[model samples]
Target: MPAVLAHAFAPHSHDSATKTDAALESSRHGLRALVISFAALMATAALQAVIVARSGSVALLGDTLHNLADALTALPLGVAFWLGRRAATRRFTYGYGRAEDLAGIVIVALIAASAALAGYQAVKRLIDPAEVRLLGLVAAAGVVGFAGNELVARYRIRVGRRIGSAALVADGLHARTDGLTSLAVVLSAAGAALGLPLADPIIGLLITIAICLVLKDAARQICHRLMDAVDPALVETAERILAGVPGVENVGAVRLRWIGHALRAEVEIAVRHDATLLQAHAVAVAAEHRLIHELPHLRAATVHADPDGPPGADHHAILSAHR
Candidate 1:
C-alpha cells in the first residue's frame, strides 16, 4: 500500500480574511452585471408590451412575454451571486457557491413557463382569430424589440463569459432567442399587412416553439453544471499542468467541478517511491501552485500525492465506494 498524503487549499494562498473579501468582490461584480442586463431587458419588454396592447399582435405579445421572462431570470441569479459571497458555515463547509446552480434550475423553469404561456396564447388566438391593428407601429415596435434584445444579449454574453457565469450566459442566449422572435414578429406584421390576418398567430406559435428549443438548450447546460460535468479540454489542461511540475513522476485522476462561476479541482499525482514524505509534499505544493497559475477560473484545489508503484486498490477505488 502506498502512503497517500492529501491536502486541500482554499482560494489562492491568501489568508481567510483576504479570501472572504475577494469572494465578496467577485460576487459584487456578478451582481452588477446581472443588474445592468435586467434593467435593459425590462425596459425593452415594457416598450414592447405597450405596442402589444395597442396593436393586439399575438406574435409581438409572445415576444414581449419571453423578454420579460428572460429579464426575471436576473433575480434568481442575482440572489445566488449574493449568497455566494457569504462565508462558509459549519453546515456548509464548501460555502454557498452551489446556490448559482440551483438558481440556474429556477431560470430553466421560468423559461419553460414562458414558453407554455406563449404557446397557449398563440393557440387560443388561432382558434378565435383577433384582428391585428396598427400594422406600422407594430412593425416599428418589433424593430425596437430586436435592437434592445440584441444589445442586452451581447452585453450579457460578454460579461458572463468574462466572469465564467454559466447562468448568465444561458440568460444571454435566452435574450438572443427573444431577438429572433422579435424578427419573427416583424415578418408576421408584413404578412398581416398583405391581407393574411392569420399570420400573426402562426408566427406566435413559431416563436413559442423557438422558445421551447432554447429552453431545452438552457436546461441541458444547467443540468450539466448541476451534475458536475466538465469539458474534457479542461481536464487535459490540468493534466498538462501537473505533468510539467518537477519531481512529479505521473499524473493520476484529475477531477474538476464548477462552484458557481469558479472551478475547483481534485488532482492525484504520483511521485518517486523512494522520495521522502517532505519531498513528495513539496512536489504536491509545486503542482498546486502551477495549477492555480495555469487553470482558468480556478477558485480552490485539493492535491493528493501518491507514491508511484504497480497499483493500489485503495487509490483505484471509486470515489463513493471508498471509505
Candidate 2:
C-alpha cells in the first residue's frame, strides 16, 4: 500500500452540521461588531468635525479624518463576513474565506491614503501658520475622541480575538492608534493656549507619523495572512498530538493554514510496515480525531499514514517521476 489518507470531513454527519453552524455564528458576530463600532466611530468623527470647523485646528481635523476612515473600513469587512457565510461552490473548493484577506488589503490602502492626506495638511499648515481659535473646545473634543476610540478598540479587539480574525484585530489596533493621536490634539490645544504658535501644526505632523506607524503594522498583518502564515506553536502542538497516537511510529511533514479565521491541517505519520490496511486506516482516523479536538480553531484535518519501510527501501520511489 502506498498510503492511506483519512479526512475529518463527513458531509452527512451531525458533527459537520455543528461546525457549519459555528462558522455562521462567527460571521454574524463579526458583522455585529462592525456595525456597532461603525456607529460609535461615526459619532465621534462628527463631533470632532464640528470642533474642527469652529476652531480651525489642523491636528483635530486630521484626527477626525482618520476616525472617519477607520469607521468606513467596517464596510469592506462586513461584506467579507457575509461572503464568508456562503456555501462552497464546485468551482471554488475553498469557498469565500479569502474575501476577508482581500478586505484587509482594502483597509491598508485606506490607511495609507488617510496618512498621506494628513501629512499634506500638516506640512501646508506648518509653512503658513494659522491661528487656532476655540482652544477650550478643541481640547474637549480631543478628550471625547480618545474616549470613543478607546472604547471601540477594546470591543473590536475582544471580538476579533474570540473569532480568530486577523483583520478585525488589525482594525482594533488601528483604533487604539487613533486614540493616541487624539490625545496629541489636546497637546496642540495646550501649546496654543501657552506661547508656542507652531504647536498645533507640529502636533498635526506627529499625528500623521502615528498613522504611518499604524499603516505599517496593519500591512504586515494582512500580508502574513495572505501568505498563509500560521503560528509556529500550532505546528509544534500538532506534532506532539500525532506522536502520542497509538501505532504512529513517527510524525513527518505537518502543515497548517488559516481559511479565514478557521484552520485546516495536513499531516503525514509513519506506521509499522507489517500493519494491515485496516490498521493503518484506523490509526489515521484516530490522529485526525485527536487533532480536531485539541487544536484551537481547527475546522478539519487530513491525515496520511505512511508505512515504515526499511531504512534503505524508498517507499516513494514510484512517485519520484511525478515529483
Candidate 3:
C-alpha cells in the first residue's frame, strides 16, 4: 500500500465539540459588540438629527446620515457572524464564512453611498448658500456623535482582533472614519460661527473625500480576506511547528486560510523514505497534533505525508507518469 495519505487532524467528537464551542464563543463576542455599538450609534444619530432639524446645518445632517448608516451596518454584520456559526453543508464545503466577506462588501457600498449623498448636499449648499443657525448646539451634537462612534470603534477593534475577524476590524475602522467626519462637523460649525458661511459646505465636501479614502482602505482589507491572504508570520509559525516534529525529515508546502474567524491549514511533510506505512502515519499525526496545540486559532489541518527522497510534487508526477 502507498505510504502517502491525507488526514484531517480532527477525528474525535470531543475535538469537534471543543471547536464548535470556541466558534460559538467567538460569535457571541462579536454579537455583543455589534449590539452595543448599534444602540449607541442610533442614539447619537437621533440626537444629532434633532440638532440638524433645529440648526439646518448641512454638515450636521451629513454626519447624522453617516451615523445612521453606521448603525444599520451592524445588522448585516450580525447576520453574517450568525451565519458563520452554521455547520458546513455538502453544497457548501466551507460553510458560511464567506458571508462575512460579503457583508464587508455591503459595508463598503453603504459607505460609498453616504459619501455620494454627502457630496451632493455639500455641492448644492455651495451653489445656493443657507445661513447655518445655532452654531454652538451643532458643535455640541458633533462632539456627541464623535464620542459615541469612537467608543464603539475601540470596542469593536479590540474584540475583532482578539477573535481574528477581518470583517469586524473593517467595521471598526469605518466607525472611526465616521467619528472623524463628525469632528469635521465641529469644524464646519466653527467656520460658520466665524462668519465664513461657505466653510460649512466646504467642510462637508472635505468630509466626503475623507470617507472615500476610508472606503478604499476597508475594501482593500476585505479583498485581502477574500483572496486567502494569510499573514506570512502565520505560515512561518506552521512551518516551524512541522519542522519540530521528530520524524518529519522535510517540510514541504504549508498553506493557511481564514474561514470566518477560524483558520485551517494544509501541510505537506516528508518522512524517511524507508519508513513503514505505520511509521509515516504516526509522524503525520504527530505533526498535525503539534500544529493544533501550538496554534490557538487553527481549527483544522490536513497533513500529507511523502517520502523524504525527493520533492513531493515531482516524485508524485514521475510515479504517476511512469504508471
Candidate 4:
C-alpha cells in the first residue's frame, strides 16, 4: 500500500470508532447541510436551465449544468455518512471511514468533467452565435441563485471544517461553483445588456477553466493519499513517538499509514532480551497510547520488540514458547 500524505488531504480514520462524539456530530451536521444544499441547488439549476434554454444563452446553460453537478457531489457524501457508521468486517477490516474520502474524489472528478463539457459547448456556441432574447432575465436569475448558494456554501464549509469531513468539503466546493457561476452570469448579462454579444460564451469558458484548476488540486491530494505519500513532518512525528518511550532503544521498521482519518502503525523496537512478556506488553501498550495521543488520527498500533544486544540472543517481545 502507498503511504498517505498528512498535509494534502484531511486525516484518514481507517481504524477509529466513527461512533465517537466528534466524528458522529461532525458527520451528522455536515451531512444535513449537504442534503439541503443539494436540494436547493437542483431547484435552482432547473430554473436557470429553463431561463437559459428560452433565451439561447450559453453562459446560463453552463451555469445550470454546474448546479446539476452539485447533486453528484452531495449524493455521494450522504451515502458515505451513513455507510461510514458501519462496524469493521472480516472482508474489509479497516472499516468504511475511507468511503467518504473516496466519495470526495468521485465528486471532484464529476465537477471537473462538467466544467470540461461546459467549456467545449461554450466554444462551439461562440463559433456559431445564436440570437438570445431577454438578457435581463438571465442576469436576474443569476443574482438570485448566487445569493442563495452563497449562504448555503458558507455555512456548509464552516460545519464541514469543524468536523474534518472531506465529503462536506467537496460538497462545499459544489456550492461554491454555483456562486461563481452566478457571478460569471452577472458579468455576462451586463456585457450582453451593454451590447457585447461575445460575453455570454466567454464567461462560460472562464467558469469552465476555474473548475478545472480547482479540481486539479483535489485530484492531486486524492492520488497522494492513495499512494501513501508520507511527508517529512509526519515522519518526524512518528520518530518522536518511538524515541520518547522509556524502554525503546530505537524504532527499526516503522510502517506508518493513515488508517482512514487516523494513523495506523507497526513498529519494531529494540529492547533487552531479559524483558518479560508483561513488561514488554506494558511498554507496547504505553507506546500505542502515546502515539494515539500525539496523532489524533492513529487507529491501531502493533509494536514488535527486538533484543538490543547479541546474535545469540533470547527473545524479547515474544517468547519462543508462545510462538
Best by lDDT: 2
lDDT of 2 by residue, 193-307 (tens): 9978899999999999999999999899889999999999999999999999998999999999888877888889988887877777778788888998788877778787788
Best of the two (2, 3) by lDDT = 2
What are the per-residue Cα lDDT tens digits for candidate 3 across 1-323? 33233332222112467777888899999999999999999999999999999998989888988998889889989999999988889999878878888888888888888889988999999999999999999999999989999999999999999887878877887899899999999999999988899988999888888878987998888899889998999999999999999999999999899988888888898888878777877888888888977876887888887787743445577578666
lDDT of 2: 0.89
lDDT of 3: 0.86
The model with the greater TM-score, 1 or 2, is: 2
Q: Kindly report which residue pairs in candidate 1 clash with one another.
A: none
Off by over 4 Å in 2: 1-15
Cα-based TM-score, every candidate: 0.91, 0.94, 0.91, 0.77
lDDT against the true structure, each candidate: 0.85, 0.89, 0.86, 0.71
Across 154-173, the per-residue lDDT of candidate 4 in tens digits comes to 87787766665544654576
lDDT of 4 at 190: 88
Ranking by lDDT: 2, 3, 1, 4
Q: What TM-score does prediction 4 earn?
A: 0.77
Residue 61 of model 3: what lDDT?
Answer: 84
How much is the lDDT of residue 248 in candidate 1?
A: 92
Q: After superposition, how far is residue 222 of candidate 2 from its true place, in Å?
A: 1.2
Poorest 10 consecutive residues by lDDT, candidate 1:
6-15
Give the C-alpha miss distance for residue 20 in model 1, angstroms.
4.8
